[model samples]
Target: MSDELPDSIHLVLVERLPNHIAVVTLNRPEVRNAINPAITSELGHVVQALNADDVWVIVLTGAGDKAFCAGADLTTVGSGQLDDLWTDDAGFAGFVFAKRTKPWIAAVNGAALAGGLEMALACDMIVADERSTFGLPEVRVGLVAIAGGAFRLPRVIPPAIAFEMIATGQSIGAQRAFSLGLVNSVAPAGDSVTIALELATRIAGNAPIPVRESLAIARRTSDLTESELVRMSDEAWSRLSKTEDFAEGPRAFLEKRSPIWLGR
Candidate 1:
């Protein structure tokens, strides 16, 4: 990891970790880390840079302990600045619809509502603090969660529960989210980012190529038939088997030592 800002990033804090993990914090605690055009644009740049860099895992969180994100900045929306809220390539928050290939872990420190929840739904896994809350209250304002929340939520959790959350505009606690499999884990209040970093460290220790390929297959085959998914998996495995890390795994096992992954 280098000591420089990936790009001239301001709205989002980008920290490259020693273990090939990047911690990206939405830096708008003044507004509960609300999503604005500046944050979205900078985040999109950061994500694009990280994707091309050596970073293998990404941990996304908000700046302060108050809230991971209160959702889109209502002030901007109310002012009819909706057009600036989303980017051409990256959708809302520069994440919801981005072509992210690396594994992303959402560290929900506090309330993640509306677009905030949608951003979390876009991630590969979510780690929430005990005090954190998740919701899609867009319907309360006569709006819909068109930021991938309506579609992804149902696929991740039960349809009934998803519908209930969307229809009623009610938020669920972290523990409840964990129970419904929406969150991978629930840490103590204010410790969501730490737990997420630990999880990212574990994932960063693996062979990057295989880990990325596996994540790609899992994400891409979600709506495919069993046979189609199998075919995709077979193709992924065929590509993975040729990597140097693939041979190193067994060789290291035979040598009775931890494998040294070159990520080739």
Candidate 2:
């Protein structure tokens, strides 16, 4: 039965790069990197594995230049295996809701619509090719972007713009997305991953604990009240204070030298 499993099980590739960065590529480019059951399960497993590994940052992208992901492979989702399109931990693509501590960067090379956009939204940052486009076009096909797009987009960008995209099934260009603060940077064609790697390197150079702490707190800024945020920040500071990196940060500054992070 294991051998009989669909090749989609291996359709996700993981590459550990320098500077403690891991690249997870969706390999089903022939179908525009659509997520099937195997992809969902495999990606979830990969994300979990990376979370426990020494990886400081993770980059997600698709195999081809045509798409980051087209969302669920309806061919499979429409079958009796709808449940298979999800994992117990992450709802879709094994990523949109997965628990993770490390920063994730979405390298969007082309179209990132529907579930594709949801996956990108889950990332801490986005690096998109200038030629790429983004949208939650599920409405075009009688579906709703329930995989996080319907809500996450509005939080990331203007609510009116996000609502229009959702209701009309339209996509915005990369420049517009950048101006709307949806993308951190726009890269040249096929350079989304390269740009992402550069950003990851910069992040990796920082103290891992503080970086993670800062990102976690920043992400909660929208959901938490001001008082709650202050308390959370204080709590995070207390936890970070115990890490070796925390002490090294100040000591290194005093010594005018770079600090080596222990990631504790």
Candidate 3:
């Protein structure tokens, strides 16, 4: 069904100059973008394909304006179909639980709760719609969140707030999330994806190697011990010194011109 040209409802991938940005959308907007097993499996494949194609960045969102993603499809919850749908990567909802070498952005278009929020947390950055809301309602449903929600939530927001969200199932507004530093940006509803793409475009203009390396170092050193931080910083500095972009930066500055980064 998604065999047509660009802008398919299933998954849309586009190339913009020096960058390739893949947008994975939750196709089932009729059910508030609830994710089924097939969607999950396809998500894994899509991510793999994008990475293999050397895409510098990826932005994931839902197909409609009403919701980015509600959560796992309730219809498949008890059918044991959800388990089978997961790819070998164990990525709860595609790339959320998988290891990715590149940077990703979660353009949260609307209501992002439970698995949806988990998916956003998995991304390197999150930009949400002003009308969007976030929560973890698994406790209320008598089920634990299995999609990296528990582990990732605490890391994104204050520990107490994350715990409270999981325990009370309280949904927070987009402004509150942005204030907590959980969301990178809050755009007008229905404009979240546009703002995200704008941001991605800016990011894609820079050298790709540094972007990936910086993300890797930041994540690695986020909660490091003193010794580990020292080691990581030393190694990262040494590694960056070896890149061609490292030399191009200073030369460009001295020459009063824009850098022509080779991303080497």
In lDDT terms, how accurate is model 2?
Answer: 0.89
Candidate 3: regions farther than 4 A off: 1-19
Q: What is the C-alpha lDDT profile of model 2 across 195-252, one tens digit per residue?
A: 9999999999998988988998998988899999999999999998887777898899
Clashes in each model (backbone N, CA, C under 3 Å)?
Answer: 0, 0, 0
lDDT of 3 by residue, 48-164 (tens): 666655567778888788888888777888786767545567567666767787788889988898788888888889999999999989898777877888878888899999999
Supply the TM-score for candidate 2: 0.94
The runs of at least 3 residues in candidate 2 whose Cα sits more than 4 Å from the true structure, single-residue gaps closed, are 1-9
TM-score, each model?
0.95, 0.94, 0.88
Query: Could you give the C-alpha RMSD of every candidate to the true structure, in order shown?
Result: 2.4, 3.3, 3.4
**Candidate 1 Cα outliers beyond 4 Å, as residue runs:** 1-8
Better-scoring candidate (lDDT), 1 or 2: 1
lDDT by candidate, in order shown: 0.89, 0.89, 0.78
Sorted on lDDT, best first, the list reads 1, 2, 3
